[model samples]
Target: MSAFSDVELLHDFLTEAGDLLEDVDSKLVELEQSPEDAELLATVFRGFHTIKGGAGFLEATHLVELCHKTENLFDKLRSKKLLLDAEMMDSIMAATGEVHRMFGEMRNGHQPGAAPVELLDALDAAIEGRTVAAAAVVEQVAIQTASEQAHSPVVAEDDLDWAGLYEAVVGVAPRELEQAALSTGMATEAISRQAAAAVRPKAPASKAKAAGPATTTAKENSIRVDTVRFDQILNLSGEIGLTKNRLSCLFQSINAGVVNDDLIKSLDTVVGQLDMLVSDLQSAVMKARMQPVGRVFQKYSRLARDVSRQLGKDVELVIEGAETEVDKSILEELNDPLIHLVRNAVDHGIETIEDRIACGKNPKGIVNLSARQTGDHIVIEIQDDGRGMRPEIIREKAVEKGLISSEEAGQLSVQESLQLIFLPGFSTKDQISDISGRGVGMDVVKTNIQRLNGRIEIQSEPGHGSKITILLPLTLAILPVLMLKLEEQIYSLPLSSVREIIPIEEDRVQFVSGKPTMVVRGEVIPLLDLATLIGRESNPGPKVGVLAVSGDRACILAVDSLVGQDEVMIKPLEGIKPKGVAGATLSGEGLLVLVLELRELIEGKL
Candidate 1:
């Protein structure tokens, strides 16, 4: 049997190899800085060596070849034989990337193919460059070709002549196979194979079932399941939530006192116990899916280093609160957004080395990325102590992009001006660099955060520095929400964003620039009727207001009444999800209530 047919072994190899690749990639970046760190060099070498062994066992020959070359190079570096250089580090990083790609290919059930000879040759050249500075070879064997070959020979994604070809290949004589099909020139005629297949009796469905997806039926099956059983817990928890709908119907039927007090007490006790059990299960499952954000943060360390080097600037990435844990799903979705933010920090937020020195700032620019659990949300801040954003330049760019009129742009508050950065098609750089100048990233970051029920806040000063704060929910699947009523229609607001529920006073209301404004604790905040925001008729009677804040901005949402608070399982809508509505959940009353996307609702109005 093929090594990959041993599903258990293959999964083990994939998991271990993936981790090794990440570790080696990070160590390679560190080794670039301290070329002589023998300890780090040894760690990286072993990481590659172990992966090579596993790949070899899996018959992933191409991956083995690439890792073997990297391991050998690291071995030489560790022994003080071949010294590490920028060019050499680049080659190693590229080789590691190829190894990662190979793992992905294997994961998708594709046979691993050879790396481009150019890449293998580049690895050889980088190792050789210690003595000869193999510039010619490195140029000849470019990583560009490797990337091209990685996904080369794009063919029609359809099966062609599978049955006939399978029979032709299998029908070859044993003697001919001994001589090799190539030497024997055993090319089967297409017409003859088709005729033979036509003449052959059709196999029953049982035989076809036995054939399945692979060439052989001897392969055993195994699966890689999450240790936390998050899916299982979530599925069962969703079923438990249906009890709300049932109870709502039951209460409606029992409104006439047909149900006795004893029965009510019994139902209440059972439900209360079930709720506690479900909550415990949820916590346990969430804990299982909870991985330290450091796993994602660690990747950016190498990314920031590489980006800063490419930009020819001296910058250090400081990571904090990496041990803070979040849902695995959140971590995966957060990766791209974080990458864009970090790259911008390296390319745009930081000043050039010479400029920093001239300004009497430290030659080394600092981009600090940090995450911490604040209440129900995880706050991630990417702050840089480099060139800060100037509101004047932002206003000019906003006007140029037709995002705002010149006069309107001029009137924008500092906070509002900083927000222009998150508008699509707004970029400050005069010249577009390969890294960031397309002006497409920040807006996407904001959109993604909001998709995850999160918020992004940008703060910058003319000369001090710039800070982008992202506030994200602990998880996207479930949330604790305060269910509210707007004229008999139910709605839910994220409990974390709700600061306080207060009564709306007729006299305290005033006009601020023609918008409704109210004072709370001597601070005036813009107020909007929640009903009007969601396209319902405004309620004129005395109303309750929910004070909600997104980052530094605060607003009051006027609602008809507060129904109470509950934990909700928010199911995403299918198509054309309406604005200001993230998803829907069931109120205990058996009615589907829209979960208010606080960011969209407040931002659109205020």
Candidate 2:
């Protein structure tokens, strides 16, 4: 294989190896709680064994040796000769870190540094003083049985054809396997044989049953096909849709002229059917990119455990809606924000054990992560049972930082004050710590989430807990919008942001402090004219189209006319933030229009 192929193969191996390592950490944490779980121990042993084998083939002697030693310690525990204690668990956890560092160094195209020899010696020492008399007796019985069978016909176990079994177990493409083999310095054929052997059942009865299926059972297998194929299909489907749209335009022109009504009606029906088929195809292709949130949520178990241990706090992390699926792209971008949030919950949001207990709460605080689909949005929430935010303290900090006047802070609601923490360079901690309270994380969280066109909401009670809810579009590719007219130009508003629309008489509007205000349901709500805000003023008319948009606060938008609702594909404004525009969309009338940013518009009001 070429060098490029080798690099690609190694990169893929590194990705999978990282995932496996994370799994091992999580399993180890679970074993801490259920120390006597035999199956869990077996699973951990197999994972380490697999890592060792892979590293050995790659000539990563240091990594292989580390895993080998770790595996030996597990072997002693599995055989009931050694007991699992806190010290042993800590040592194993440190070994996990060592292996991870070695893998990281190897991924960066350098040799891994030697691990601490003392740690290796300590691991070896843990296996001493174990009575293996029962293990030896069992080995003797197996050896005797094998010796008894040696006198009979010697059928070679290695003679079994294993190509089908290899495909069933690994499910990697033949070429990918070949590349992996070349990179790892193993013969492709040998690696394939080993994969088959690894998956084979040890029981004699299962081996006998493997030979009975002669009817060519279609394999019932799958491969991890590249996502680029689905993307291509989606692009082609989009082109077909555009063609259908143009054809509809032609049909409208024909209907306006002298045409056969029957033919026109038949053509319309066919076009509608084709449109539905194309939509279904798009939906199916998009679903292929959907992955359950559990893939990302699983890593939190290890993170929570390690961070809580380091901080000397006892915290339990719980996950819900692990089965909710989102686009792969969204899932990938969401990892950092989620990590930051979890770390913040542990480091800042949750109080210490004594503090929590004194507050009449569980000493081991609970951090719950959940996601669910609501309309066209996916709502992900992180709630922590800790000392929630105190609005008064936040107000004092804001006043000290000059973020708000003391009088303004005194009148602010709890929800509004909690949002002040998200401001840039705002920290509530008295002293900066390594973990958090440096006033850096939450701002980045808000910025990154906004770049994805998502909104975050904070809810808290002083003594209960706090919940941060994030609302994101299901897919960024397409969105449902409400199209409205401002003067002669049409603009779109994401339906997710729009609350409602109402027609109001111009006479009922009042000016409050040189700004337009309207009374709706006994509440004074601020109103902004869409044209004037976008720098295009129009003459006052008899009635105004009021678009009520709600974010952290509610605002009324006055436009010229309500065009209608639409399901338009949002095209981002690249390299520039348009004046008072959130995004641009193509209307059914073949016109380009801008979408207003409701949050920005409301913020501009202050």
- Runs off by more than 4 Å, candidate 1: 5-12, 129-279, 461-464, 486-489, 497-562, 573-580, 589-591, 598-606
Candidate 2 lDDT over 114-196, as tens digits, reads: 77776676677666743332211211121122122121111123222223333432344322443332233333344334443
Lowest summed lDDT across 10 adjacent residues in model 2 is found at 134-143
Worst 10 residues of 1 by lDDT: 150-159
Cα lDDT of model 1 by residue, 83-192, tens digit: 88777876776677677668768877776788767668878876775343333333322123222222111111111232332234335432333333222332223323
Question: TM-scores of all models?
Answer: 0.70, 0.69
Which regions of candidate 2 deviate over 4 angstroms?
1-5, 56-62, 94-262, 356-362, 414-420, 447-464, 485-489, 502-550, 557-562, 573-585, 594-596, 600-605
Predictions in order: lDDT: 0.72, 0.69
For model 2, name the residue pairs that clash.
none
* Residue pairs in collision within model 1: none
Q: Identify the leading candidate in terms of lDDT.
A: 1
